[model samples]
Target: MSTTPSDASRPSLIRWPERLGYGVGDTACCLFWAIVSSYLNLFYTDVFGLAPAALAWLLLITRIWDAAFDPVVGMIADRTSTRWGKFRPWILWSIVPFMVAEIALFTTPHLGPTGKLVYAYITYSVVMLIYSAINVPYGALLGVITDDSAERTTLASYRFIGAFVGNFIVQGILLYLVQALGRGNNRLGYTLAVTILACGSGLLLFYVFLSTNERIQPPQAENSVRRDLRDLLGNRPWLVLFAMGAISLVYLTLRQVASVYYVTYYMGDRGLIPAFLLAGTAFSILGAMLAPWMARRVGCKKRTFILLTLWAAACNAATALAGPRDLVLIFGTQMLGSMPLAAIFPLMGSMFADTADYGELKFGRRATGLIFAGSTFSQKTGGAIGAAIVNLVLSSVGYVANAKQSASVLGGLRHLMGTLPAAGGLLVAGLALFYEIDTKREREIGAAIAARVRSVAAGRPSDS
Candidate 1:
């Protein structure tokens, strides 16, 4: 629990297995994550048979809860002092609850639409709540696990690569699995898939809890909620990341929801869904793998993020130009686009760790849990809005479930896939331009924070 001089003064080398486990933890989280992000829209509309407009209302209403709760959960996690550490205990607490909530969320009751809507509201809210419990802490782990800048980036890469593995498992094979396992009862198929994935997620998260440690402790004197909020709001680097996190999820959620409709309606092939999502997941993995190397090649993570996000934006926009049935053009453009979007996940994560340090050095408070909670806040707030917009647009364009889509609906899918997400990516690029923490500030902050922590532990004045 106490900091050693070496732990405070230098970058601690995270072992390969620990890094791998940290990554695996995210992979586990993504099993649930990808399920909600990729399939929940389709499941709610097609399988559960909810009307588009109704589902839009559901998403919009529930997002309010998501936006509000993440920071509270983060604050709780930050204040929690445990022998297991500040963040890891939440992972342990969440495993069983997460399993139950996820299964309940995906389950379809035989109630009427009104009753079912109520069921959805309660279950969906529970799932998102538990997800924040595990995830906000896990994300905060990145800042605490190691303060080394390069190691944070590497860990983030591992984290997201693991995330896409979960993404690939669900996105790539869930449809086929549903088809095979459902045997014409698609609802049962979904239930079965969630059950299997949920069990696996619990086990992997247990491993994450046992394997990881919260090494970089927060500063000793952070107690005021008002001051914490003020510091978080005032931190400029954090402000930029907060915006980027929101836009990034907007980009991701819109594209993910649109991809299904694009294949099912636009291409007239429901069968291609798995492969298309698989391709995107594969490219996402590749992008995550190359993120660290790409950052190194460009000699700066910030520049790499800007360049790659712009590239991804261009690729998404190009998809609009392709003919609906042109598989080659569609796949090629998306795969190209997915790589950069994927690349930015790690970049954004590492940059967040930087913000934690910068906020601490600048504001004299280390709200790692609260700061990282903003990442989840942005994700849920942004993702929920994006999902709502897509559904509402589908309704506005006269989308009908299980029937032939109108030309207006088909065209809307293209714009959702292309224009909206491209615009989100471009916004990410533009926001990165305003980010002020470069390598120079990273070192200064890391050093200053290290000295500050070291001095506190030694009961002396901080050289920082």
Candidate 2:
């Protein structure tokens, strides 16, 4: 176990620049992911001409690989001790391979069904696993950055800002890039868009590596991997977080997959997709900025639950009510729906850090990496399930490749894009009800734990 300093002696503030840089890197990575998540299914079904079910299965199987790989990456990151810091080294080394794999995944050659599935499986699986190596550690690094609750919230806000920027770059710019590069060849457009994504992603990774420093150090503990896994599984708060994350995955995945279809098919205006996305992104940013204030005033759990539920209901109802002529209303509802998402994502990161602290207090070792890895694994699994559901639903609605869909199909697609996600969002909000860790409770726990650590280090014993 690592020795602890007294709470009174802890730093009052975290450096803002470091936090911003971290967010920048996170934004870049997420931008690339958003591109993949938002457009890849469409590309596969329409451009690559692969079966929707096949694509779904491929995504599902790759996620199994991601789940299997997460813990291993976490363990490796925890044990790693390079001059660059445990997490930073992974971030540093992963840049090239991550970019390369992303490019390859998007640039796969036109092939027959089996060949296309094989190409998708090999490239996507590799990209996911490699990305995990970097992402697990990066996620874990959030807890190590600061122990101050206020500072952590600030950091999370900046992080979400980066995420929003990344979303903007990908969803906003990449669409235009594809059109420019495709020049009538849709496949070429995807390939060029991915190339641009790779460059942006690489630059962001470099910025993160150059700008951030790891101020907090992990405690040296003598547990084997087996024991670490056991300790992680024993954490109740973290278990709840994982469940919540799964629900978030379902919500985000559905929204991403639906965006292209909603604008292209339903609205009959593919160009409007970027505008709708930007509106949603702007709303999400506003919501995230307000979240910390809301949490402090009403309590994080309560505010989260209420906001998410309302957002979900509004989103679903808007889709149900809007007709083709009511595109304005539909976009308005989407912007409204984004409010909770922006608030929720950043809060979720902070909550995971809180869970890490709780786990440390109970187990006497800091297993930040493992705890975050579990969260990441759950998220990836949920994404996989979401992808599967989207594919299956589209297929069931009689969607055909490179052809106009029937009215029934379009109706069903709208429902999946709108109501289904709203329901998933509500389900996640309901899960938030089970969370027992309020902001007040968390502060108390932090103080008690810090005092206990201080006493123990001073060769005295204290009951927390």
Candidate 3:
């Protein structure tokens, strides 16, 4: 275990620059995420003309690998030692490889369908694996950054503001960037755009390495993966978050991955894709900014998350009735849907961090990396299921790329945005109801952990 004098004291205010810089890392992570979440399925579809079923298999398999791999990475990260700290060092180590893999994932190789399918598996796996290596640790960084529960929530807000900024950059500009850079070659445009953005993402991660410090650690230097797993499974708050994370993402991914096809095919305007996505991104930023205030005002992060999740889903469901030319209805629902969707992320982050505290206080052990990684596992699994559902629906509906669709096919797209998300949203809200930690409980946990860490620090003077 490691603890500075400051670590012995919970609620120490982190300076603005460091907090901002830490948040900036999420911006980079989210930038890449925007690409994958928003466009990867489209890329796979157009790249080789694979059946949507094949593409669904591709997404499902790769994401399954990605989800399962998070816990292993988290375990490794928990045991890691370095001058830079356990989590930040992973960012430094993985950033370059991550960029390389990102570019590879976007590059379109000339090949037959079978060859292309194989290539997709290889490249997607590499990119997703590299992403897990960096991202799991980065999420874990929140738990170690500060012990202050309120400050942790505040920092989570800033982190997601950076996230929405990343989404803004990609949503508002990537298509235009691809067009301008491609000179009318869609393949070339994606390659060039991804390459440019990959470099920027790498630089932002490097800034995180330079700007952040790890201040809190467990009371023991020893680690037990079995214990970590056992503790995680037994932790009620973690279990609720785990379920909520999965179902919420299943809903979110279905809509996000469906949006491109919906806009181009159902809405009858390809140009509307960028605008539609941007409206969601812009409002997501508003949601992220409002989350902390709302949580405080609502008297608990858990309650705020429930309200936002339900509202977001209802808004998404309402979009089902919109006609092809109902621009107001479509965009209005998008803005309404995205705001609450965005707000939930920071609250989720804070709640997960609180769960880590809850585990240590209860179990006499700490593994921040493993706990956050479990959260990631839930989210990635949900996203995989959601994406798989989208692909299966498209395949079943006789969707032909860049072609006019039947009424039923268009109806399928509308139901994806509406019906599927509503069910998932209700499940997520219901799961959230079981989350026991309020702001009051979170503070009590933090203070108790601090006192124990202080006792351990006194016994081991060298740690101070």
Candidate 4:
């Protein structure tokens, strides 16, 4: 394990108000994101009139853009100096564009098929770019809000609760809202519903800007981008987490996209889509709520993360046995699977913060924004890979839009929804074991970084 000078002082405890303030941003983000990630594939195929092959390419292309884009945003944010702080300023600046891009994503324009595809490409690309601008900073802000590992866990839980709330609302009410708003026109309903959600998302982000503060300050000396990139490359913990987050996202994206198809076709009850989404996410909240306590009991975040993820994998794999007629059993298994998944994001996020501290301790500089940016990139990349796989699998199985699926199609859907996610879960669990940062090591990094900050502020050289 690495070592640095010990500091007696620890970061102050975060208040509930500030914690809630930080959480609301994710709620707003998810309002846009949950809809796009969970429902976009459906919208593209069913309403937007895109072929599965086209949608697959679209997902891959956009995520490739994110691969380059997210890291640049992170690097810029790190080099940024502002009265509002490095991360918080972007949150304030990007809100309008973010909202506009979201609205554009759900808007249905009457155009030729090629025109519509072009519009989809432009709008979706803009939305993701804007998302990186806003959300990359938002995630990096978690590191500055507080340095306490335990407190970060608590904050992550609250953040995910807010995320779950957004998911619940979207899954439970969005379609109904669209139905009510559109009356007979699906296009109009989607537009109006997303418009309302976009406005709400913006307001919540404003609250985050107003309510949170950046407490942990980065180093005063400006480092070259090359140096920062070099540091990032050497960050072992961050690399482990980056890989883990990517794999985790693969499962999450696949399962969420597949659930819509599974309900619409196999279950033959599109009405139950919202209910199914609601139950799974709601149970996930319970899992997230329990994460801090579980971490404490296990004596490390890695253990808690690994155990919960594997449990979710088991639950997801069990769904393979449930046929179309096993409605109650299917839903029950989904709820059970979601419980462990609920904690996964929060736990992993807290762990990432640890990795950030580790990077600082080892590299003699801090790059919170860059680290989380890498994480965000991994997630988007994972989503891209997963989405492509699902769409291609659907096409290969002869899944026709708005028609009864053949047995091959049903089998493909089952594997996509069940086996794939379970495999991802196991992969996450396995990769986590390679992560070196634990609670004790995290606390040590914090202390060392704190001492280094003090030394720099006092015009003394840093020991690292």
Candidate 5:
């Protein structure tokens, strides 16, 4: 927790390789994330033979546990003082556990329904716990890597490009690999697939640790846990981000997970899954590349986000208008819908960094770990709630696993994939109106924080 005066002066200090390294770390992380968010429920219900309602409970309970546990991890990370830095050390230490938990999560054991459910709970919980350990610190790393708001946005764009590439691999290549490698055994395919993904993710994380540096170090005197929590709670921008994280993730999760069902059941072609996902991921990559430019043009991140969100909503609605037999229309809408969303992740990450700046500017202390950990809580909670809601809706509509879906169930799948998520996107757009951190204001805040840091470093009283 020590930063030099040099670190304070240069806002856009990160080099291209460093930025590339940072983005690669997220690409690695998103491998597991893309698989779980896009396919875990389907894996449980279809491949693992768990009931939809039971699976719902498992997702809900585990995510609630994640929300509660994230802050403790955050607090520990903030207090951590390592040669490598506070946040990077966690990434170093937690990779093994994260790898182990991931493999266990996708491995199906030979057990009765009861035993299977127990196994799901055990494996998923461990994976999530380890996930929080690594990812919370990873998110916090963004703030410390560079205090430059514009550079952070650029870095976020790179990060989501990595994310889309990871998703493309998982979404486009994974199922086919599973089918090919498993031959006929889905369980085997999942186990082998996840093993490869987990191993690759570990290597990428190692690279992140080696290639990146944390520049925004904390003061030697740490804030008390209570004080940190108070500052976090009082941070208006962070609060907006927290709520936005959950709400938007719910929309994202439902739309992503439901697409599997939509293609498989409604379209009656399991082979199309890879193609559909690849199309969306490709378009998403384009969107990620375009985000910064779009935001600059629109005059602020919030406004650009709103425009993109509304565009996404329209794309989703268009998907709903296409019938089950309309393969071309479905694919077209999926690609179009996903394009704008590609911008959202990078924009959100950049904005979360802004909230950290806001917290420091307003509260006189920086708790990057705590603030980002709360964001992790919001994400897991939203994902869990969204998954649970999808499962419940599927169950209510008489969705029988591995059987031909009824018309009613097909309708439900379409709504889950399209209409509901579209509405959620609109809600996210509306909520963005309340968040007041524009690019101009962000620079103003960043400069002030830099001045405060310099004052404190020189043994003078900081006016903050």
Candidate 6:
């Protein structure tokens, strides 16, 4: 098994239009996710009249379900083969069911508390499973797209840009659209929001299906699910990265859910929620835009560690210091802190691909699906933990559902929103400190691998 490619090896860089198309689809999917993550709790507590503890249980259980299924889905994807390629077929197959599940999640039927809980469970579980189906493969597709390290970074940038745009649309514009659509009826408004999100998600999936091409066509490794899992566990770097992913998921989930309470209760300007979210998202886009250039200079892992540390410190300080009167300071801090997060996504994706390569090199089996599944599992688990924490914190602080809170209660909510997430961010940065891969090292590995592949193809004996 050679690692390097010959001089005549086909170039792996994707065309720009294809990249843009993939970006659009990814953005749309993220838009739906952002809406769900940012607003679902609010919708349940305020709109659906579900108690926080009850909602927490529902979320927790569903996430547990999701966590259980993620690895299985990964194993399935690894074993999958089709004319369209392993990943794309999953993406294509998931479109309709994914849309239906998403719409179901947001549909606010006039149901009793028991009915609502049932609905939440059924819809959330289905959506999560379908989401895992598409998302795992979608993430794994990055490795399949190209073997060129720099180009992979470029693709990651485009992907992050798409994610930023999706976040912007969901957090920045979706609420306003809901208001416009429903006017006076909150239920009708949210329903409209769900419809728009579902349609957008479907459209984006179609775009991804049409635009992107899989280049690194490794023959599907014929392995049992147990063997694939064992192979993934054997990859030390991949295991480390999976640990990092868990930390990141916690940080991201806290950030997403807390921001809503911070704006609504602490800052006393529920209207500014969109502005606050947009500011951070916009900064994230800027950060992603700068990643390629920065990675080339300082290497992806080191740059990520440095920036995330700075972000953690700034965010924590901002949370601890900001009061109701200090709106500008609070918002400014969040925006500045979010920039580093933007840079992290693409770099993280590149690292996962690198781990995929390392796995192939060491194990002589490509378990891209399994690797990507670890990422999905971490993120979902994080979201689950965050949801549980948010609910527990709110309940502990005497957060009464759908009622005006006392000043002290509001202050407590603010702290949970700001300080807790800041702390999580700090933990995430510390965890990332152990990431040892650097761009120079990655390039060297890529070059060596390419050379080995080339030698083998040329019928010359080569050492790899």
Q: How many clashing pairs does model 6 include? A: 10
Local distance difference test values of all predictions, in order: 0.88, 0.78, 0.88, 0.86, 0.88, 0.77
lDDT value, residue 106 of candidate 4: 90
Candidate 5 local lDDT, 52-148, one digit each (tens): 9898898999888987889989999999888998999999999999998999999999999999999999999989999898888988888899877
Clashing residue pair totals per candidate (backbone < 3 A): 0, 0, 0, 0, 0, 10
True-structure lDDT of candidate 1 = 0.88
**Over all chains combined, what TM-score does candidate 3 have?**
0.96
The TM-scores of all predictions, comma-separated, are 0.97, 0.95, 0.96, 0.96, 0.97, 0.93
| Candidate 6 TM-score, C-alpha based | 0.93
Better of 2 and 4 by TM-score: 4
Per-residue lDDT tens digits of candidate 4, residues 1-464? 11222322545558999999988888998998889878989988988888898889988998779767999999999888888888988988999998888888998898988999999999999989989999999999888888778888999998898888888878887999889999978888999999999999999999999999887776544588898889888999889999998899899888888899998888888888998899998898888788888889999888888999999899889888789989888999899999888888999888888888887788767888998899899989998888988899888898898888899989988898898899889888999999998877776787777777667657898786
Under the 3 Å rule for N, CA and C atoms, how many clashes does model 1 have?
0
Regions more than 4 Å wrong, model 1: 1-3, 454-459
Give stretches of model 3 more than 4 Å off.
1-5, 457-464
Query: Tens-digit lDDT track for model 6 on 296-408?
Result: 77656656556765665677567667777797788787788777777877878878888877776666577777888887787788789888778777877788865678876
Candidate whose lDDT is highest? 3
Q: Where is model 2 more than 4 Å wrong at Cα?
A: 1-8, 461-464
User: CA shift at 380, candidate 2, in angstroms?
Assistant: 1.1
Model 6 Cα shift for residue 240 (angstroms): 1.8
